[model samples]
Structure formats: C-alpha cells, structure tokens
Target: MFYWLLKYVVLGPVLKCLFRPDVTGLEHVPATGPVILACNHLSFSDSIFTPLIVKRKVTFVAKAEYFTGKGIKGWLMRQFFVGTGTIPVDRSGGKAARAALDTQLRVLLAGSIAGIYPEGTRSPDGRLYRGKTGVARLALESGAPVVPVALLNTDEIQPTGKLIPKIKRVRLRFGAPLDFCRYSGSVGDRFVERAVTDEIMYELMTLTGREYVDVYAASLKTSVEAPRPAAGAFEPLEDRAR
Candidate 1:
C-alpha cells in the first residue's frame, strides 16, 4: 500500500518531474513470474530510479547498517528503504552472506522480482567492476531469467556522499533476459559460478559501454580509504582477469 502510494501518488510524481528518466527496452522484463535484474551499481540513486521505472516492485537487499542506525534520521532511512521494497541484510561475508542469499532466494521462489547488483558494491569509478557470484547462485537456484539492466548518468544525479541530487536526466536500458538453465545443477560449483558472473558482467559492459575492471569494487575502496578511484590506474581487462 505504501509502495503504491509512494510510486504513484507521493514520491513518484516528484521524481519523474525532477529527473525525467528516459528508459528503453522495458519490454524485455517479463510481465509476471520471478526474474533477476542484474545491474551495474554506479550510484546510490540506482536503487531509487530502478523501482520508479520498472512497473513491478523490485526487491533489493541493502546493507544492515541502513536499517540499524540511530535517531530520527535512521528511522527515516529505514522507512524509505522499506517503502522502496528494500530489505536489510548483513553484507559481511560468511554466515551473514549466506543468510542474505537465503532471504533473496525466498523472495524469488515466491515468484517475485529480485534486483541484484552483481558488482557487490557501487563502482568507485565509472568503470564496471567484476561481479560477485551471488547473482549467479540466485539465478541458478531459482531458475529465473537474468535481465541485464544499465542505469546511465545516475552517478551525476546522486554521487557518493551527496545529500541532495542535482537535477539531471536519467537513462535506463534493459537488455534481453539471459537464461542460464544450461547450468541448472551447477549452482554450488565455484568455476561455474565464476563463469556465470563473468557472463553477466560482460552483458553489463556491453550495455553501459563502461570500461571493465576485473577487481572487486570493494577492494579498491579499502585501498584508497574511499570510493574514489585514483586517476588512470585501472588494469586492462585482457591483462588482468585472464
């Protein structure tokens, strides 16, 4: 109810008016049934604008901190995420990571759309980073088609640490759904999962036309102590990942 109200009546109108998102290839998304929207994470607004454009409700897993903060700001953040169809999960790996995967699997098996950022975290630079295998696991386990989605220019609208977004036109593209049913029984296989993850990342690279960085975005964040990448220091795709 709140989701509908926010999308159609309250926040949707305001966002549509301000950003005027230009979306394409929406027909690629199936009208019903479970599906995975594997997207490249560029900015915080990727979450906001994706649900706004897609007709069906998109369920995304956000870091647990977003739901566990203190004060009124925390309450507001929690409400916003919930209303936007986001659930909180501990992104810290190990048991917590498995739990998060289980949560999303439930959502998918229940015949709902699950939006996943395969890159694990937002790109520090504009370049697309290597994807995490969680998306592959979800697709293989759920047997849902994976749709490669690219949200262009969202970073400019709401870059990291920017409270207010600048008024900018957002563009979104949805590619044809990828079927990995060939690897149906290979969910737990690390090599198969890596291949699936790479395939999804390749589609994202083609869709967004961004440079491909084989390193995980989270690792780069730790090295620099921030999300900003050092200029001209990325590895060549052929020389690095291969």
Candidate 2:
C-alpha cells in the first residue's frame, strides 16, 4: 500500500528527523475503530505533519483545486495528496457540503480515522476561530468519537503562503475523545450542531491556549469586510467558557 510505504519507509523517517515533533496525549487516540480527529487549522503543513505523526492513516478532504492544478508542480501536488489518501471536494456547488460529509461518513463507517478541521479554513491570525458545525454533523451521523487535536507552532514553520516549511520543532496535543451518543439521531438539528461545535472549539482553545475569536476564519480572509464583533469579541477561553 502506498500509504503505509510513504508513511513508514519513505517520508516518515525524514520528517521525524527534521521536525523532531513533540507530541502529547497520543494515547487518547483509539488504536482501532472509526474516530474523528477534529483539529484546529493552522498551516498547510498541519495536513502533512499530523498524518506523519499519527500511527494510523488519517483521511482528510482537501479542496478540489489542489488536485486540478496545471504544470509539473500541479502534477506533483495532485500526486502527493492522492498518494496520501486525501479526497478532493469541489467546494463550489450547493451540494458541496453534503458531498464532503458523505465522503467522510463513508470513511468513518468503514472503521477508519477521518481528520477534519471544523474551523472551515485556516485562522487568518494565530488566534482560534469559531468552528463550523459540519464536524458535529459527521460525528452524529457516523456515531464516531471526536478527538480534539491542537497543532502548535505549525503556522510558524509554514505560514499561509510559504511553499516550503522551515525546519522547526512541531508540537501536537490530543485531547480525550468526546462521546456524543446522548445526541443520537439529532444530526440535522442546527441548535445541537452548534452546541457540539462550540464544545469542540472550547477544547481546542484550552489545548492551544490561543485567544478565541467568535468569528469564522474564512470570513476574515475575504475582501468583503467582516462585521465588527461586540465589545467582548475576543476573550480568554477560561472567561469565555463562563
């Protein structure tokens, strides 16, 4: 299998030697079974490093554009993502959301780990942003436990537009798995979805110790001005938890 070969034999050894990543709470990840790894989106390297560090394969859904680029660079990019088992989702149509969910559900239902970034997009700043509810939807639909993962200092290694990552120490922290069986059969309920997403974001905030912004990260990246937040828009996770 190309996945195992790349992970254990080819790329894994090189990455381990280069990053020397310090990971903690790895025991929280279930050794086997369907599990959802809901991690905060930092750098593009988050995709590469997290999978390399985790023992099991983590299937992630990436933007379709990454797989449809032109030229030799595009070919290499497509090959890398495809080789690593990344699914490409065209986030353009009204059905895009459902398609991505379905893809992830299939992976989870097959007793595999599905890695998702609930924030929808990477944080424009280093601060943590509000998470989207798709992660909660996946958990409820697939009956899988959600593990909150925090990737620290990855943005520094590869900032938003940086092609190559600078050699730096990377850190990952995995929190205890969150069981949502109490909300079984509540997959499409918006209120319940929001609650679950907020809970996951809170855990990520605590783990990364980053300032929590109540705004969606993608909105801030767009040219359209993001609406101003209220007086207490940014707050410490401890204070916000109250």
Candidate 3:
C-alpha cells in the first residue's frame, strides 16, 4: 500500500518528469520470481532511481546509518526507506556480513527481487571495483538468476556530499540475466564462487564501460591511509641533502 502510494502518488510523477531517466533492458528482468539485481553503485540516488524505473518491487540492502540518524530529517528518511521496502544492513565486516546475508537470503527465498551492489559500496572514483563473493553465495544458495544493471550519469545529478541533486538526465541499462547453473558447489571447490562473481562484474563492466579494478571496494579505504610523500618532496635522501 505504502509502496504504491509513494511510487504513484508522491515521488513517481515528480521523478519521471524531472530526470526522465532512460531505462533499457527492463524486459530482461523476470516478470515474477526470486532474482538478484546486481548493480554498480555510483551515487546515493542510485537506490531511489533504480526502483523508480523498474515495474516490479525491488528491495535493496541500505546502510543502517540511513535508518539510525538523529532528528526530524532523519526520522523522515528512515520512514521513506522503510516504506520503500529497503532492509537496513550493518556495513561492518565478518559477523555483520553473515547477518546481512541472512536477511537477503530470506528476501530471495520469498520469491522477490533482492537488489545488491556487488561492489558493496558506492564507487568513490566511478570505476567498477571487484565484486564481493557474497552476491554469488546468495545466488547459488537461493538458486536465483543474477541481473547486471548499469546506472549511467546518476552521479552527475547527485554526487557524494551534495545535499541536493541537479536536474540531469540519467540512463539505466539492464543486461540479460546471467545463468550460473553449470557449476555445482563441491567440497573445497571455492573457485565456482569466484568464477560466478567475476562473471557478474565482467558483465557490469561491459555495460557501464568503467575501468575494472581487481581490488574490493572496501580495500580502497586502506589505500587512502597508506603513507604518501609530501607534495614536491625529493625522491631520495641525496636530492633532499642537495
């Protein structure tokens, strides 16, 4: 009830008229059944825009911080996300991964589309990063097909740290559903999972045309913290001494 109300009444008309997003390959999405919408996350609005264009109800695992903020704006944001059928997920590693996957598995088991960003977080540099194996695990465990969705130019409208979005057109390209029925999970045969994950990311790369990085999105944080020489610093002690 609330989903329809928001989609048809509140936001649907406005968003449709404003951004006028070009959605392609929507027919590739199964009319009904459990499936995974694996997408490349570009901006905060990726969550909102993707669902708006799709005809069926698509649920995503949103960051828990969006639900647990302070004050009135936070309250409204939480309500909106909840109304849209998003599940709050803790981004912490290990135990949190298990818990979040538990929720996603339940959603898939219930025969609904579970939207996931295989890269696990928004692309800080707009390049597709290596996907985590969790997406493959869910698809394999749930026996659901994976659909690769590429969102284009959404970041141009609303980038990270920008409170308001600029009026700009966006494009959403949905690739054909990827079938991974060939590989059976066997003892010590973890390569299947890696192969499945790599296949999905490769399709996403082709659709989005972004440079592929072999590193996981989470590892980029460490890259930022690694030591860097100061600007214009000499490369060697001899040069500094001179």
Q: What lDDT score belongs to each candidate, Candidate 1 first?
A: 0.87, 0.87, 0.84
lDDT of 2 at 89: 80
Q: What are the candidates' C-alpha RMSDs?
A: 4.9, 4.8, 8.7
For candidate 1, the TM-score is 0.92
For 36-70, candidate 3 gives per-residue lDDT tens digits of 99999878999999889888899998989999989
Cα-based TM-score, every candidate: 0.92, 0.91, 0.89
Return the TM-score for candidate 2, rounded to 2 decimals. 0.91
Ranked candidates (TM-score, high to low): 1, 2, 3
Q: Any runs in candidate 3 off by more than 4 Å, and if so which?
A: 186-189, 225-242
lDDT: worst 10-residue window of model 1: 231-240
Output the TM-score of candidate 3.
0.89
lDDT of 2 by residue, 1-242 (tens): 98888899988999999999889999999999999999998788888988998899999988898999999999988988898999888766359877988999999999999999999888777778999899999999999999999987787778778898999878789999999999999978999999999999999999888888898887787855444333234433553575
Q: Flag the better candidate by TM-score, 1 or 2.
A: 1
Clashing residue pairs for model 1: none
**Which tens-of-lDDT digit does each residue in 90-167 have in candidate 1?**
877899988888988999999999999998888877789989999999999999999999876677678777878889
